[model samples]
Every structure is written in structure tokens, then in C-alpha cells.
Target chain A: MDHSSKRGDRPGVSRRDFLRGTGAAATAVASLVKVPGVEAQEAKSGADVVAIGPGPVKLSLEVNGTTMTTNVEPRVTLLDALRNYLDVTGCKKVCDRGTCGACTVMVDGKPIYSCTMLALEAEGKKIRTAESLIDGGKLDPVPAAFVACDAQQCGFCTPGFVVAMRAVLDANPKATPAEVEKGLAGNICRCGTYEQMRHAIEDLCKAGGK
Target chain B: MDNFVYYRPKTAEAAVGLLDAKWGTAELLAGGTDLVSLQKQYIARPKKVISLSQVQGLDQIEQSRGWPMTFKIGAGVKLATLAASSALRGSAAALAQAAEEIAGPQIRNMATLGGSLCQRNRCWYFRDEQSPCLLKGGDKCFALDGENRYHAIFTQGRKCVIASPSTVATPLMVLGAIAQVLSPKGKREIPLAEFFKAPTGPEDREHVLAPDEMLLSVSFSIASDKVKSASYEVRQKLSSDWPLVQASVAFELDGGTAKNVRIALGHVAPVPMLSAEAAKAIEGKPINEETAAAAGEAATSGAKPLSQNGYKVRLLAVAVKRALLTAAGAKKYWEV
Candidate 1:
């Protein structure tokens, strides 16, 4: 007799639900399980929550000391997520097969190929991309030295070199020529700017990586 | 690359459980340095991926003090970390050198010991995804007759012409390393020799790991006080390239003579090739250029080279000689 009044008294019940009927309401609740590629545990919370997805899933990442949230498909690499979704395009994508160091980024203080790493795998780590090198409108010592020494000609590979060089110098402050050679061996410049790259790194080493 | 579901399990048991649940449709993801490339090439297209990145505490390098000192290298430890580990560098120098010589710094930064060992063959035909090589369940092996340069010289009587691609496997074999594998059913340990299996047929993988199993860690006894070891790889480019041939020598020295020795060659066979003949040649002999040359000659005694890769036989010999000389602290040949 007063079904609408009783439904209203029940908190969180929608006014539109009365017109749609309870069958539609039940269907809406049941649709949550229809999410494709998601495991049953995705509905649960805590460590038990296993988000297996080809579909989009929300992720919280600590990037360059900033907490950023983004939704990404499980198949999306960290490099793609950073460049496409988060607008962190400083990391270049080249030889996306993990061969070229063009997509190098620091995950948990260690340089890793971002193109080969899934964004979901880097969920709890501190990710530092090449974009993090700039401070107060000034370039980091390594990138500044790259410019001063003309380490880049085509300039497409500059960002990866800069990020990798930062890791090298941070790991070894007074790196020798051999050490620097081994350290920078990961990144390549097809323009044959390696001599200049080494010179720029030597300059940074001399400047104490300020 | 084909889209797929990804699972990041925090524990080894959970990871194994996921693999068990997914069964034939899942692939374990570690490092992704090689797996991503395989995926990009469509060589590996698993419907579900189980990422081991969340499995913590599997990255430690511990050296236990025993009668024969043992070193346990976690499967999750990066190749770069292993290469730079002072503990490993001091005790297991060959392993460190092999780790350092793998690919380049960026690849090593993302590669792990288990991933390197479990990596599929680098045969171009097999990796093409369209070549329909015998290793991929095709009727014929393209590498057997087409561009057979990088194909194995000693294929261990298998139809597949692919050679083992693991640089670490060579040194680990010489060191007598054991792999601790964990499965949903239980755990098991396999020696490096048994861990890598030569492809017997079209459907055979490079290793014998089951779909539900994962390599947990690798353990090796430290080289004794009487032994000296070294790893030598003859890569095309010093920058970042696969080796044409790699050799690792572990020599037990008595005064200046080799009491006993173990030598293993890589890229010359389907598995890391241990040359018992080479080891026998130099046993009870003085560590000199002559003995080293004899051992080198012995290493290539039975090599059946493919048309384009006959040069690999000479390279393998030279690698063995140089590796032995280096391990014995003798003057290295081929310096010029």
C-alpha cells in the first residue's frame, strides 16, 4: 500500500529504483562481478586483494615524491602509463623490448627499464623519472653538463641518458673513466655522441655532481 | 603485444597457486627483461601473467660459513646487483664476471639469475613467431638449414638447432650450482646440468620446469682455497651483445700444476656444454700455455659445426684456453 514510503525510509535507496523495480536494483549489484579479467579477490580489501586485470584498475604511485593516482590496464607498461596517462613523457620509448635504455627510470632507487615493467608491479615503489631532474626551472647537473658538452645531437636519447647518468654518479661519486664507461654502457646515442657523453659525465664528476 | 591479465602475488606460495589455478594459460613474470620482448614479438602470449615483483625478501645474497662454504643467491636479485656484490665477487668470482658480462648495464639492471637461466633460446627463426620452427611445434627447424650461423654446433642430438643463451649458466655449471625450485605441490632442487634440458622434440622447452613451478634460488659451494676460477666470453661487441662463445674454468691448483679442473662452454651447444675431455687434458699437468692449448684443443674435439658457424669451434677453443690461463694466473693469450 505504501511501498514507496517504506523504500524511502530505507537509507541509500534511490528514488529512481521505485520506478525500475528491485530486479533492476539486484542486477546493478550483480554487475560488479561482470568486470572482465578481474579475479574474484578484486572485490576484497587488504593483502588478499589480487587485482588480475586486462581491464583498468586504480593505482596509487609515489612519483618524484608526489602521490599520483591513475587507472591503467594490467597489460600497460609503466613507461606507457607515465607518458600516456600521467603526462610524464620525459622517459623516451625506444626498443621497448628492454634492450635500449631509452625508457630507464629509477624504481625504488634503482634504475630499471620502465618499458619492460608493468605499472601494477611498480605500485608501491618510489618511481623517479627523467622529469624529476629539473628543480626551480634549472636542469640537474648531469643534464646541464649534457647540454654544455653537446652530448646529444638528435636529442631523442637525452632523457634516458640523463636519468641513467644520475643513477651512475649517485652510486659512485668519484667514478673513474672505466667505471663511467661501464655505468653509461646501458644508454646509447645513435648519433655517435658517446665521446661527448663521456665528456659531459666527466664534467659532472668534476663538479661533484652538484 | 597482446593484452593479458596480470597478477602480483606477494608470496611464492600465492604466485605458485595462481600458476596452478591458471594452469596452461599462465606465465610467471620476473624481471620481464626477456619476457616483455618475447611478448612483444608474440613469441610468448600467455592469457594470464603472474608477476613475482611483490615477492619480497628473495633478493638477499647470503654466504654461509661451512666446510665447503655455500652461497645462496636469491632468484629475485638483479644481475647488476649480483655482478657488483663484493661478497660474490670475492668468493664466486666467475659467477660475478659472468653476471657482469651479460648484455649491458640496463638489461642487467632488470635481469635476474632465474630469468637468465630460464630464458628461451635466441634462435632468430624461433623468435620470429612466423617461422614455425621445430622448437615451436612446427614440422621443421628453419635454423637447421636457413641462416644456421648462430645455431648450435653441438645440439645434443636434438632436432632444435637453438643454443643456450644464458651467460650465467656457463659459470654456474662449472661451479656445480643447484637450483631450488618451488611448485604448488612441493619443492625440489635440481643441479644446473639437470636444470637445463636439451630440446628433445618440437614441444620441448629449453628447461624442464613445469608450468606450475618457479626457480626459487640458486646455491653453489664456494671455490675451495686450492681453486681459482674465471669466466671469459667472446661477444661480438664489447658494449651489449650476446657472446659468440663463452667459457668458464675452475682449476684446483697444487703448487703450479692443475690437480683437477672443470670447464664449461656456452653458445656451442643446446645446454651449457661441460667438456670432460677438456678437463681431462689438463689434469695433473702444469698450468702453462701448452697445457691450456691442449685443453682448448680437447674442448672442440667433438664439435659438429653448422655451415655458417664453423668459426664458433675455434672461438670456443680460444675461450677455453684463455679462461684456463686466466684462472691459473698465467699470462693470458690472444691479448693482442
Candidate 2:
């Protein structure tokens, strides 16, 4: 809904000039083909908020097997909604920058970072988190293995890894140590629990007996 | 973090038209991996945010007779999807490998090749609001004498010390591809090799596209002859984080001897750079350990790492060697 990422208006220096002249000689020949897909935008600028049709709307998100509804700003990130509004605090907020996988969640059977995802972007989609690891006070195997294998030290990054490992294990129960490592590469354990995490996933495969 | 208006355009023109109306103040959001980081670091605070996610036909990755023997990947295509794709996983495996190695699955899910290529510098000075690096038009580049490890040695000049962050473009450079852009004015298709810019300028620009333009898609036409390609990346670890160094090697075999060797180095220069001289050094050689080792040496022969990043120079060599083996149909890493 916002195009702020396209502007090179950083502080001090004007990156617009830097980004333009850097790639010269190649962009000389150009053509424009107008194919309509996006909503017809009002041809105006400098407005702080542009409401194309309807104003702000209330919505519901079924997170961690619970239907939670709230009024969300267009700019609200899923992480912000989960942390500040809904209080589903299992997803850690470390490295609020998208580089860290501390806020990973599953939407429609695929894993994606909630931090980078806009709150409204994932509307009506299935959302899962580390909070879903326990069923009726029973620990899920992947998470149970994480605790048994001591795959966590601080417990902050553990939830992110558990969600990611669940996705990997769902697809490949016998995923090798390398596969496990690659699968969880997005999830970072600051306490250096990599070896234990690998063992945890390996133990899950062993228990599956496949 | 500046207060801004955000708009979502569902098509290439809608995205371009939004850029046209808010030309100077608008920013494009594809994956937000680079832009969000830049915003957090206060490097870019665009007044307007336009989304390319809902744009149809721009996210398609398929082969059709309308285009040549090619892969048409939409600009909004996610890196994770590209990595997991079986067709891409095999034929254009190097690009897939590079895509998979970026940040992590979540980042790959959000990050796109088009966004990664057009992203701003990951340099600390450029990103941090505190520093006034030359790329920001300040006098001193901190990487000149400061913590210069990840900065470029090959394309470094007096202005900037940042390295290009796209792992996808390195393999694209080897694949003989072109990037298509649509703006309010018109559309233009530029060769992938010429789309990037050097940082050795007072203006400090990176790509050839105008400020009001949005990337439509990147078109890949196969090479003139049969060329096997692979890409190798060296990172601190496997994750969504950027790579420390990357190399893409495409080898054309003339039955026995190598011909038309194309070697491009990423994170070692200001742009997704091709070392033609380095590639020429082993143009007619075989893909044996000896030849690949030699090509690796040539890839770094004239490389000048920043004072602290000497390890990257050798790191790139290993990547080149492994990529050469992969390009030569080395069937070991694909077992899984």
C-alpha cells in the first residue's frame, strides 16, 4: 500500500542522484506498455495517507488456532499485531530487521517472516506459530525434542526455530543434518544452539523410525 | 520511518503510474528485505510506498513459445519459490543456489531478484545515520581505513566501498539475460550486464533505470551455444543474511576444451561484475581440478580486498572452483 521503499531519500546525501547516474549507457532505449491491473490510483502526491476506496477497516486473523479480530492500520506489520495487540508473544522480536528469523510463521502451509509481512497482507490466510506446538497441554515432538536436546539457551529464538523445523519435518521427516541446517538457516539462535538444534531434528527423525 | 503514504498497485502500469504521479517521492516495495532494512537504518525514508505484490503477470515464472527457450520470472517472484522450484533447481541451479542462500526462507519468501538487484548498499556507513560516507556525498569513506572487511576491493574507488548485494544477478549475468522496466514514460529492456552501475562517481547512482521506473520482468535468452552454469556463494553461515562473497561460472565446452567462459563475481565489486580477463584466462581449458583452480586464481588475480577483507579474496576463489565444477556437470552436490 506504501511506496516509501522506492524513494532514495536517506539523510544527508541524495541517493536519487547516486542511483540514477551509476547505471548509464544501458538505459538509453526505453518503451512503455500500459497494462492495467492495480486499482486506479488518484494521480496526486504528498498526501500522508491515500485511501483508494474504503477507509480503514476492521479485520480478523485466525492465529495459532484462535480467531482474533482487531482494528489494524494499513501499515501494521503482522509482528506488531501479534506482539502489541493480540499478546501472542511466542514469536520473538529480535532483529526487528527482517534478517533474523525470530518472527517466522506458517501461512497457507508455507513459512514466511511475519516482520516483513504487512498485517493486512496475510488476511484470511492460515497462520501458525510456536504457540501451536502444544496440543491440549501435550508437547509437539519437534518442540519436545528441542527441549530434550537442549536446543535453546535463552528461549527467545527457540520458537522461531520450532516453527521452521515443523515445516521442514512436515515435508521431510528424514531430513539429514545438512537438510535440517539448510531448512533452519533462516532461523538464528544467538546462543549458538545450532548443533543441538540439528540433534533435535535428527532425534525427531529417529523417533519417527522412518 | 518517516510518515508516508502507502499504495498498492496490482499491475505494471498501475505501479508505474503511481511512480509517475509521485515520481520523486515514491519508493517501490517488492520484498522489503533491503528497503525495510534501509528504512530502519534511516538510509531511505520514502514519502510514498507502492507495492508490486498484487501485480499479475509480473510474478509468473514459466516457459512459453511466445518467448524463446527461456524462463520468464516475474519481478514479484519470491526467492524462496524460485529456490524450491524443481525446474529452476536443476537447469538454472546456480541462480537457485544463490537465491536459497540469501537471508532465509522468510526473507526469500519476501525478497525478489528484482528487488535484491535494485537494493541499496548494505555498507555500515551508507546505512547508518551517523556516518557520512562518500556514497552519501560526504568527504571520507569510512571503509578506506576503518572496518573494511565486507567492502569491495575490485570496484572500490575514492567514493564508496559498498558491494552489490544481489546473489540472483551474478547468475543472471552468466545467463545472458535482460531486465525489462516500465515507467510512466515508457518501457525499456536493458541487458543484465549493463543494468548495474559503478560507485566511482560523484552522482553515486547504481542502475540505469530512471527514478520513476518500476522493473517489469527479467527476460533470459539462452546462450548462443550450450553452456553449463553454476553459482557458488560464501557466507558466514546459511541464512537470509547477505553473502560474504559469491561467484557465478558458466562454462561452454567445445567437446574437450572450454570455450566462452563467463565468470562474474558478486560482493567483491560495486556491481554484479564480470571478469572477462579472468574468464579468458581459462577459455579453452577443461573443467578439471587444475583448470578450475587456475580459473579461480585468475578470478582473484587483480582483486584488491579492503585492508581487512583479504580472506574474502580467497573465499571467492573457492566459490569459483566449486561453481566451475558444478557448471561442468559435477553431479555431487545435487544428490539430495
Candidate 3:
């Protein structure tokens, strides 16, 4: 599958720039104060103290081995920053809350729900999305096992399942079927494809034995 | 979620300084797992948010050597680290087990110890934005007459009937943990038992923390070799659902008799309920099917179950019985 072609659907103008243009128009109607030098005042009290805005602020994130920059409000979640702004939409936002793992991504080599984390908190950390599971235009072994067992139906939750499976294998290459099931407990599939997913786990364990 | 000014402070003092003296002006952000959802639902609308992620040394778990070993776990320590720490597994196995059973893998990776303990109650009425519940400064608690299958069984007439949501609080209370709090005035230690309280009024919180105060860390002594500790939880589903009922037990085994027994029950009361009667039933007696069952019965002595939550009373007793037997290293009666 040509996964890179999914990026073609994004708009040319970023969401941050569009929001900034609209925000300036809204500010003209209601005069909101945008205080400058707030960072400097906080820095004087402590070396590492820094303050940002109620408006859009610049954030630099390292995603999938590339440093990307965007302007977002502090209320924006990492999943929104990735899917809407950065044009990396492999991680699905099925349940915006932390319950479902459809928005799962690896931050600092640990799988976490992207919707539950603020984009500003991800600064200076290594982030890996589901798109990174493809190596040189080829699917990784974990995703390949899913294909062999036909583990997905609607395919909305495939990316998260693949990424979580890869993380489990990366941490322990010889992980058993039961261990993989426990590690992937955070994810859910409304299509009720868990029986096929169990077959995929058995196939992955068999392949790992070689 | 509404827009708010974000501040990342380097030190604990600076973080507390940014907080307002009045409630709901400024809020602390630990892992953003619970706070973000609360903000999205408009349940918490803080004007200023203080992020504690940048603070140094708040994520470390250190063990101090002494006559009786002690452990100081920073509030920022993630639940994943607590569940997998070999030191905690050997010293406090019940705490590790409780941490492992909470939520799921992704949530455990993002949730911190302090955030889990300070999380709001999960009653459906309180969580609904449109409902005028008592916890949200409304006139009456809807859970009393509405659908209340998950409401508290031991409200003690406090008005709100939401059960305490922290799974780790049960084990922490049994282990005699102390919460170290930091404020603009100074630092003070509050015992874990006194740290939790039921909300009395509309402006009350589930914990005893003031708006300007932040939980710095939690300290507890390691259990000796003679101490046997265990935690058991009953849940509807093993994947990410909250526990229906849970119990944590710790006791010293002197020859064949149990002594100094401590019992704590969760998800049945407004706070982590410590049962003195349950402890008395098993004290100075050999842990067997009869004594364990008696202790379990005593744990539910004062429970006044609501209209739809009468099943929780029996589940709480079974949980206490199983936890006691597991701590004593006895046979698995339920398995047979």
C-alpha cells in the first residue's frame, strides 16, 4: 500500500496560519491584551520558568525523526496537532478521551494516547506515529502479521494496533501471545475483530520463534 | 476546552506561587490525562494552568537506608514505572499490584501517582455537564433517586454518593503512606488516611489540599520480611474498566496467628474506608476459610446500599476475604 499518498489531501495553508488570521479579526472587535516579555519576567524569578499565551504559540516537535514546527494554543492536544496541522494522520481520533487507544503514539519509546496529552508538553521529546511503522516503503513484520490473519474490518483501529504491537515487540522481541494481549489491552475495536486479532498474535509468536 | 495561559515552572515554589488563594482560579497540570478531559467537558475552567512537567527531580523514586527501609516516591512518577519497579515489587507488592490493575497500558503510561489520587469522582450525574448535581453546587444529588448502580454504598449521609475512584488509595492507606505537601508558607506531611475526605459542600474538593498547595511526594516505610501484604480487585471487565470492589490487606504472621492486621476497602465509600471490625475478626487468629469469611462479613457491617447497588455489598465482602487469604498465602478456595 502507498501510505505516503495520504498526505496529498492536506490543505496548503496550515491550520495555525488560518486561525491566526481569524484571531486577529476577532481581536479587533474585542480588544484582548497580548502581553509581551512575559517569558523574561518569569525567567528572572527562575531560570527555567516560562509562560506562553492564551492565543497561538510556536511549538517545535520531533515526530518520526523529523523536527516539525507549528503554532497552536495550549489547549490543543497532540493528536490534533499531528492530524490537523502536521498532516500526519495515521493515528485516528476515534475516542478523544484516553479510554480508546485509536490515537496511540510512542512518545519517548512509550505508547500513550495522543488525545490526552497537550502538544506543548511534547516539546523536546522524540515522538513516533503509526506512519513510522513502514520502513523503506515496506510494512513492518507486526503489520504484516495483521494482513496475514485479516485482523481488521473497518480498519479505523489498525494503525494503533500495529504501533502498539510493534512497541511490545521492540521492548521484548520474544514476547509471548499472552504478553502481547496484555500490552495491547488499551486498544478497542467496535467491529469485534478480536478473534482474528488473536490469530494474528499466534502467527507473530510463531514467526518470532525463527 | 477554553483557552488558558500556560506556565511551566522550574521549581515547586514557583509553581505554588502562581496559584491563587481562592479555588478554581489556577489549576495544576500533572500528566493531563484527567485534567484535559475535565476541561473539554467544561467541568474545570481554570484561567491559568501551571505545568509541573518541567520541574526537576519530581519523577524520581528513591529508597533511603535505615533501621526500617523507607521509600519516597515523587508525585510525578508515572504509574507504569510504579508497576514495573523491582524495588516496589519486593518491598510493597500490594501497591505494585494495585498500580498494575488501574486503567490500561496507554493510560498507565501517561497517568501519574498524584493525578490518580486527586482525580474527581466518576459518578454519571456529576460527570454530565447539564445535570445540576450536588457536587457541582446544585441543590440535590441525582444519584440518590436516579440510576445509581455505580454509586457509593457507604455514603455516611454526606449528600454526594460518588465512590472514590483511586485504586491505589486502598493499598496506600493499608501501607500507612504519608503525603508531603508544599505551599507558599512551608511544607507539611499529612497521613494518607486524613488526606482523603468526602466533599461536604458545593465548594469542597475530594482531597484536603488547598488551592495554593501542591503534593510534592509520598513517603512510606517498606514492609519487613515478616509482613504479608496483598491486593485484590473485582471488575466487570479486565480491560480499562474501574473496579467494582477492591480490598488491600497487610498483617504480620507470628507463627500461625495473624497480628497487627490492617484492612482497607475501595469503590464502596466516599473515601477509602478502613474497617476496624474487619481487622478485629482476623486478628490473633489463624487465617483460614472460617476466619477469612468472618472478616469479609464484618467489612460490610455498616454498608447502606443504595437502590441499585446492593450487589456491591456482597462483592466487597468477597474481595476482603480473598485479599486476606492471599496475604496469608493460603489456598485459593474460589479457584476450586
Candidate 4:
């Protein structure tokens, strides 16, 4: 259980030793007072270890092709970080828990529940929210299809459904209706818009060229 | 969620170093599907949170060549990757099928193998922060007398009746997988069958991992090309809901007979229960309607259902029969 003895057997310098070597003048106060970005910068500089805070730490997120910097605690979720701090509020918070896919977003081209992921874990990765579905003011084919078929009622679940459907179509544009349905099984439409959603899926599948 | 200090270690050794020796003071965060929810509910309030995301080489699936070629899957591998892995589809199809049926696309994209295996049971009383159930160090189990529908039918003398929630553990138990764990001392290997345990007290967890130890990877071997496996889950709805009862079966087929059959059931017991009686009914016999039916009946031999969960006993039987039929690639009775 005593891990300190085994740290010397490893090849690289321990995190404590590295911290000690970095600031000799502030050795007494350095361990007690944690600097916000010092250890994180060392981690990015290829250091073996990084320790951030019980307090707010500097966080940089590449969201919608823009790098936004902020400071937040580790407990903040990616959904909260996007909606509260970064001012990118396309992803809605319905269930807050991961059950309802109301907070779906794409991380590194895969659809995930943003509420279940930490903002710190999303660093150095590409994040795409429902806001990214438009290009040059033109709606993506998935949302356009939803609009044409009137696939939404209250519009609460639309953003998550659109992002999730876009992911399926982006992965396979020629995906069958069954494939799309399987891909969208995570999202729920409590407003009973599933019948209309099927029409939208059918239209998209028939249009295949889109 | 309560705020905690975070440490992102780049190595497995460093991650273990960051763990506190005392339990309940620190927790390892990997794909926070369960931990975040627990934190929000105040069920878990660790002072230190060690993230395994920054650790190198914990996300790769590698195969080793030997007498029985083994596949080693890192604990951090996502459920989506597991469901789509061609390597697993050929050798461990049951595991792939279980992974595919879990939750929905969004959850599968974020939840990791290690996180799923280590997640807590879904009993509402245990989850409610104010309930103070037996699992939470209280005097009584709320599920035992109140709202006993989702409680376990096969109690096996355990006080807590919360059913096992991991769909993946059922298939892994049937495959005889091995868990590789890294502690502050070093590394050790534990068989999947021995790794899971029914909690005997308030302090016991579903698994035997120490607070200072972490699950590194899981490795399972296919004995031969004749191995066939499949998993079947019975749920109230086809969408994103936990299975009412699930069964996974694995066995090697000789010319016209089944050999070494293994059956594991979930959501019916505290841990994924391996049914030797069910396997015995099918061993050395050709898989057919009669044999599979007999195996199904044998699977629920010792069940002692609670007040409202007697229906689950029948569902567990049907799940076993269907899993056996699916593994053999035989005609499904329900479909016919």
C-alpha cells in the first residue's frame, strides 16, 4: 500500500521530485499552494505527471473548430462547460443524467452524452455540438430532412436527435433506415414524434445522394 | 457534484501513486458514466479524483500468438469499439453481442469496459442519498420488503438483493476471461469468475479491487475454432433500458454434440451467476428443443423468488434457452 518506496524503482523522475526541482525558492509554499496552470503546462511539455486543483484550473477546449479557454473545477461536466462557461449552448440539458440523450454531442467524430464526460477529459480533442450542424447558414441534410418531414413537436429532443442522426449519416451516408434507427436508439422522443421521425429517415434514405 | 482535486497521471505507475491508501478518500475516474452520477447524488464524495484518461497505452486491443492465441483488451476500450471489433466478433462473439445490446449509441460511445464492470448496482434505495439502505450501512434493506419487483430472486443468503447490472460481465464470465490489475505493489492476474463477489457487508464492493489498485486490461483465450458463443437479453423495451434478465452461453461443438458448455445469467443474482446445472444438462448432447428446454429449467433450479419478482424466474429460464439456441445457430422457438 505504501507506493512511495516503489516510485524510485521507475525510470522517470517522480512528480514530487519534479515539482521540487522546478521551484526551489517557493519549496515551502509550493506544495501547499497549487498554481493553476503550472503543472498542466508541464504535462503538455511531455512531463510524466500532472496535478491540478481542488480549485479552478485553466482549461482549453477546441469546440466547433474554435479553441476557447476558461477556468473551472474538475467536477464540471463537458455539457456545463459548454453551456455555462463557453457560451456554446446548442446542447440542451434535459435529464442531466446519461439516460436521456438530450445532451448528445460528437467527440472525435463519435456521438457521446456530453453530460457524462468531464471537461478536463475533453481537452486536446475535437468537440462538435448541435450548433455545428450548419455550414455557411445552410442547414445540414439531417436537420433539413427533419424540417421537411416535421419530425419534431416540442423541439426539446431535436438538437440531440439531429446531432446523433448526423453522426450516423456522416459515418455512412448510404446507411439504411434500419441502420439509422439502430444508431438513434440512444435518443428518446417523449413528445411522440417518432412517427414523423420515421418519415424523415425514409426521406433521407431515399435521397441517398444527400 | 462536489469539487475534488484532480490528478492526471501519464503512466500506470503514476496513477497508482496518486491513489490514497485509505479507501473512500480517493477514486479512479475512467469514463465518468457512473462516477459522475454518483457524485451528483452524493453517494460518492471522494476528496481526490485520479483520472486514468491521460495514462498511456490503456486503450489498445492487442493479440498475442501462442498455443491458445489470446486477445488482450485494455480496460479503457470503449463499448462501441468492443461491439465493432472484428477480432472479438470472430473469437468472442458473445462479448460483442452483450456490448452491442447495452444502453444506446451515445452511452456505448462514452462508457468504457472497466467502468461498466465496476459500476454499482441500480437499486433505487441505495442510490437515494437520504434512504440509508443496508448497502449504505443501514440496519435494513429497503428493496427486500418495499418495492421488491427488481430485487434478486436467487438471494443465496445475501442481505442486499440488488441484481447485478453489468451486461458485459455475464459474457465475460462464460468466456473465462482474466483481469489484469495493477496495484502500488505491482501487477497480478485474477480470473473473472473469482473477481466478482456478492457483497457480504456495507463496506464490500461488487468487485475485489482495492482502493489503491486499478484494472489494467482483460485477456481471454479461445481454445479452438469449434468454440461457439452468444448472448440473449430480455428487456421490457427494445430501446435504452436495462435487461430484465440476460443469459450468455459458450461451448465447443464436436461433430454433432456440445462439449464444455457454460451458461451465465445476469440480473437474477447479486453477481453474474454461473449455472453448472444448466451446463450439465447440455454437455455431451446435441443441442435441440428438448435439451435446451431442460437446460433452461435446470438454470432456475434453486431460485427462491421474493414477493413481487417471481416473474423474473420464468424470464431467466427463457433467456437461457434462447441463448443456448442462438449459440447453436438453431431455429428460434419463439420466431417459429
TM-score of chain A of 3: 0.79
Interface RMSD of 4: 4.5
Candidate 1 vs candidate 2, DockQ winner: 1
Question: Rank by DockQ, descending?
Answer: 3, 4, 1, 2
Candidate 3: clashing pairs of residues: none
How much lDDT does candidate 1 score? 0.81
- The predicted structure with the larger DockQ, 1 or 3, is 3
TM-score of each: 0.89, 0.83, 0.92, 0.90
Residues B1-336, model 2: lDDT tens digits? 433446666557767666644223667888777776666666775556776666778777976443235887888888888888887665667778777777766777677878977877678877778887776658877887898889886843445767887788899898877888886778888899999886643354567777778787887765433567888887785455568888997766778777878899999888888988769878887787777777888888778777898898888888888888877876555238
TM-score attained by model 3: 0.92
- Candidate 3: true interface contacts recovered: 0.80
lDDT for each residue of candidate 3 in B1-336, tens digit (9 for 90 to 100): 766778899999989998888777688999888889988888888777899999988899989765366889999999999999988887777889899998888999999999988888888887778997888888998988889898799866668888999888888898889999998999999999898888755577889998899999998885576777889999999769999999999888889999999999998888987899999999999999899999999999999999999999999999999999988889887885
Name the regions of candidate 1 deviating beyond 4 angstroms: A1-49, B20-24, B200-202, B333-336
Give the higher-lDDT candidate: 1 or 4: 4
Interface RMSD for every prediction, one decimal? 2.8, 7.8, 3.6, 4.5
Q: Can you tell me which runs of candidate 2 are displaced by over 4 Å?
A: A1-59, B20-24, B65-68, B156-158, B200-205, B223-225, B238-241, B330-336
Q: Is candidate 2 or candidate 3 better by TM-score?
A: 3
Cα TM-score of candidate 1: 0.89
The order by descending TM-score is 3, 4, 1, 2
